[model samples]
Target chain A: MTEKELLKQLNKLRTINAEADFKAANRQMLLAQITQGEEVKSLGYLAQLNIFMSRLFQPYAIAIMIALFFVASGAYGLTISRQAKPGDSLYLAKKLSERTKMLVAFDEKTKARLNLEFASNRVLEMNLLKQDNNQSSAKETLKNDFKNEINQAKSRLAKNQPEAKSDKTNDFKTAGSVKDNDHIDVAVPDKKVATTTNQGAGIGEVLEEAQKLFDTGAYDQAADKLNEANKLVK
Target chain B: MTAKPQTDKSSNKSDRNIFLSLKKYQDKEAFMQAYDLYFDQIFRFIFFKIGNREDAQDLASATFLRCWGYVQEGKLKSEQEYKSLRSFLYKIARNLTIDYYRQARPQASLEEAEEIAADFNPGLIEAETSIEVEFITAKLKELKSEYRNILVLKYVNDLTISEIAPILGKTKGNVRVTLYRALEALKNLTRDHDGEGITKTIK
Candidate 1:
């Protein structure tokens, strides 16, 4: 016979399939055996969970998950640190977090604004310490730190004055938005208000003048006005 | 003429995924699907090997049970072994068939008759079987076990050489050469029996 005819005849043997009744019966028996075997040696939920965890989270994956948890909790703690006083444990973290925020600011104006807000916060912290009867030395140190932060804010604003002057419409827009600092209302009025009429100016009015000076590119003068507003809080 | 089986990439991928589900999760559904898919082919394969229907049926069932036992014990090693479920099942059936022979005849050493069983039990060929089938099966029995197995896997099971290689633990080139030789041997056997009207009956 030719190979083709032989191959055709060989292919015909494929018809020797398993009988239907035998297949169905054997399948049922096999499944029952498997089910019994599974039950006999079944791992409990905890063991299965362990296996699942082991498969899903390799060493690197577990490490990544732990790192993400710390980051998330740290963020939550830092938010609470916003209220931290100078003597509190989270106080340093609060300062470092603020510094990080300032460094990440996209523009000099935003950085200067953040520094000014930080300077106000330091003065606010000092007042709270005084009320709590904290040491005089701590207040003096806070006063020095506040002065340094105000100076940095002034320098940053002065550095960006040329850009501010070029964008006249944006400068006016900045002056108009000065009232957005409604949240910065903790600054105490200066006791010298009875002696100097200008001292009678509210912190809001002093900030408004600062914004006007900024619009005119007199950034150092604007910074002096904000510094005056901060000193009055003490 | 070459008996080449078509390779379906998608189907192979799906089968591998099902096997993985069985391996990792011990998924009964996946195992059932595998059993349904290969039960007939495995039965036919065992039937060809042992030449007995009742024994073939029992061994085929045992094959799946043994496979599940391996899965439960995580005995199947390496990624390549898991790639083709059909090849893996055939490999198991082939080994079991050898063991069946070794047990059936303790007098003849398994090493001596590992490929060819001493007695093929031609009477056990299915009742109501056609003359062509009986003739081919009897002729196939005369050939050595290697030739018979290669022919059955290639033609009866429609497995490609690539699929057959891993099951037989032979190289693709070796399987191809053996397959050629097997077909030649079968053709020679038919030509020698031409006068007996066997070739005429087949035609």
Candidate 2:
């Protein structure tokens, strides 16, 4: 206890002991006696602990983060890799068909000379039913050589385009309207059978109905109908 | 102040006078410097307690002679150890006087000693004014062998409870409690003389 706290006890005994010489010294001496070296102990422990922690986890933690960064970056890169976009497939198909790299090499006004484009490959009979029958042998040859096969391939491709496209109608609808004449090329070449069968009452009929709604000042309803028209057209 | 001289003499404390600063007297040149400092304290304390000039001189001379040996041996290190050695040596001087009593007046009781102590205040001539220290030291000397050793180890030698425990072959807890009881006994003795400040004095 401090001297003040123990003062009452000291006071009571004071009168008695005063007649006699006595020392009542307290913590003053002891506190002086005990040697406390400056905070070197804590400093030592902290230095050791810091070194220990870094040594324990440094390698594994760095490795894990590097691995995670690589994994996420790989996934993100995979997600964004380029794919064929709208009308692109059709464009590709058309270009592929035209390059003489394809089967057909004829121009519209062809008086067939040796088609130097196809001349390297030999064929005996270049036959055809002539257009204006009296034209000539060379003309007939160009006409016959590629006309049948090219038309057949084109028709087959046109049919395949619609079927292939039908499955992706939702994707096409979300991506926005096919642009200008490209729209016709993308849709019409593919949907010949559907258009011939539906007459005008398929996608076109829905668009007409939506247009009527728009004219009547029901724009919201008109937009809804337009979306349905998009679905049908796709 | 005639008392029996202690027969057995195999301790470091017995070799120096309590009031002497052994550190000051530690050099060959300083031998007389130490002799001058402590000679009177040993003489008066021994003479007054034993009530005889001859034996007191003998004990006093013996105290200084042993101090001289300790100094010559170069065992006096610091002020603290020197102080400890001095106080420890005083206990030796006191025990020597007690042994003198044992041999010369074997029939005398300790009560006779206390009666002597009642008139035995050292007045202004002694080293310390604190009667509580003197009283406690006297009582500690009278305590049972183990308890007395622990008491002296605690207060006089200023050893830690941990340090004392091993010395006594007791657990630290046992040492602590024993030291406490010994202290309480000292406290009671102090209260009889001076009621307050005993606790503070020891500390």
Candidate 3:
């Protein structure tokens, strides 16, 4: 073949491209690297954290993490303990799990809600003991534990009410000071007063009704009241 | 003598602008543009060097990554290193293929080249069922690396001698000479195999 023909033949190799899929994937990867590097350069720690969180929350990464957590935390034990009765072997585990949940609840309202939940659970155990014809002493002890939980829950919910009002009052005071100093419209707290007053009254009444039902030994009614209190708090 | 391919001046200017933006401002969009400009040619160059699709893909990726690294570092010895991103990428790809051979396996001798020629299939190019193309590619594998590279760069990638010179670390005159000789060698290879009907088909 002449060199012209040879050249023409060689030119056919142009059709031999990198696979389109590979080209696109590599482009995405390289561009991602470029952007990630620039982000780190410009945004520093926050960019690094963003990248870390994004990778951490990728589907496969999240799945692996959830699997690792379930394995390490012995979630099967927790699951079985959720069904344990007051005198069962896993009862302590159940209590420990409940305590752990409360400890990590991150806010007082959530903790109060947990207290109400555990109190309702204690009443259920007491009722179960009565159905099983357990000793009166055991039922009495469970009833006392239920009363303590309900009292703690009521006090917690009640404490949140005044704190909410006080916080609104402080916010209004700060807004007044800011308005006086800067002549700005610092009226943010004016919006919170009505909402807080309505919510505080609603939660206070629910907690009071729950307490009255408990005192009357209306356990089922108290459970329903506790739920209403929980909803109000939420 | 084989005439050099015409260089598109506007495209070259565009590539230079993108490279500068990446270097000066660390612009990601510019880097992506650079990637678009060079990925196919770089991938083809590395594919010619390594004779396999997968390793060629990896080395091609590495070539672009290393180029980005240099842009990020902003500490090259001279501005000539930044003169042509295309040449810079080719150099990186060539070095990566060399490293790949050194670390992964022995260099492909003439005998292994034959084995590669026989075993290699451009199966990924689904519509490319031409036997002549396959035969030419196999013959391309049989040539020395320098001759093969010069021919592929000159003819296949349509790079000008001046553009190829920096990539191969050779003078423009040297690239011209090598490209001529490479074309002659390919002609002889095809001529010798005329019984296989390449000559008949061309005629």
Candidate 4:
């Protein structure tokens, strides 16, 4: 038969009368399942059977799978929770736990020299204070104080620099140069380093603060806190 | 229907079967009424699709599975809203056949291609018998699955492109392209096998 002729015949046969048997089967099954008010297991029962079979044949495998699942899920859940929770601020803590490694790739020795040079004025002011207490004007006193702090900060920065490479657990002193005064953006080591440095203490603390900020709807503040946390171990 | 504004004669036949199915499913009398109305036309349609008594038996069995679902369940309302129950179930049968192929896999070989091309005679098959079905079914087997499927769904099953798109998981445009391509391929394969003369007589 040609395609056209065959198609004509097929169309003629497309809507045959319904058979008695099919109606009985469909009606019985649908009624049986729907009245139960629960799932009709007959459809997907075969799939569930396979899962059970694996458990019986591989007891140890199942046990290990369960244990691993718990451990992995617990760890993932904790990590997600930490990500979800806003951390307590570095500003709030006042004492930052920054690793020293970030001091590397320093702009050049010139940056350090300039830093020290700028810091000297404060040192000179403190020295003058001992010679003639009131003789140093307020501006001079302020400069002197600032200079001493700058020098002290520089020295602290330099000594910590060597250890920063070998050990990533050094304190906030590594975040040298008062980064916009009072508030310092400390660099935390990578999670690898942070785990070694002070992972137990800091992660819990930082996570808690950031979580608090997030909960309060202070998204900007929460972000700032997280960045500071990242910097602490950078 | 209060006033079926459908002016198309095709829609009238289409509309009537739909109405019958709805009435039959709605009430037992309606069920018997619809069966009497469409039984001959629908049987002929299915017998043509499978092209053999036994498989047509199976296809017809499946067709009623849908029809019964329509009746007792009240899922489909009045047939006039639709083209007709026959069109609706034919759509189902086409899908069911494709799904049967996917499920059956290696079991469902393209049977027509095995026949010899030489001494091929479209005229040899008797005009009103299973002989013609075997020949055409053989030629049908020669077409690619996509073309064969569309040809079956559109021409063999008498479905609109609109009705077939959702069932085949395709756009209407895609269905048209596939249908035309399938027809062309079937035509070419027929020409190659039976000569261009065969294509003219069969079509």
Q: Give the TM-score of candidate 4.
A: 0.34
lDDT of 2 by residue, A50-94 (tens): 433543443333433443343333333321221211122222222
Q: Model 3: per-residue lDDT, tens digit, A122-193?
A: 767665665766567767776687767766776776767776778787888878898889867886557577
TM-scores of all candidate predictions against the true structure: 0.51, 0.24, 0.49, 0.34
Query: All models, DockQ values?
Result: 0.16, 0.00, 0.17, 0.06
Question: What value of lDDT does candidate 3 attain over all alpha carbons?
Answer: 0.66
**Worst 10 contiguous positions by lDDT, candidate 3 chain A:** A35-44
lDDT of 2 at A125: 17
Q: What share of the true interface contacts does each candidate keep?
A: 0.45, 0.00, 0.46, 0.15
Interface RMSD of each: 21.5, 37.5, 15.9, 24.2
Put down candidate 2 lDDT per residue, B1-203, tens digits, no spaces. Answer: 11122222222222232223234433221233233333454454454454444455555545544444455566544444333443434544555555455444556575554334223222322443355544443553454445555544454333455445543457779987887676565455445443355556665
The Cα error of candidate 3 at residue A185, in Å, is 88
The stretch of ten residues in a row with the least summed lDDT in candidate 3 chain B is B114-123
lDDT of 3 by residue, B51-104 (tens): 677667767777777777787798422436435667777877776666555433
Is candidate 2 or 4 superior in lDDT?
A: 4
Give the C-alpha lDDT of model 1. 0.66
Off by over 4 Å in 1: A37-234, B1-3, B6-11, B113-118, B192-203
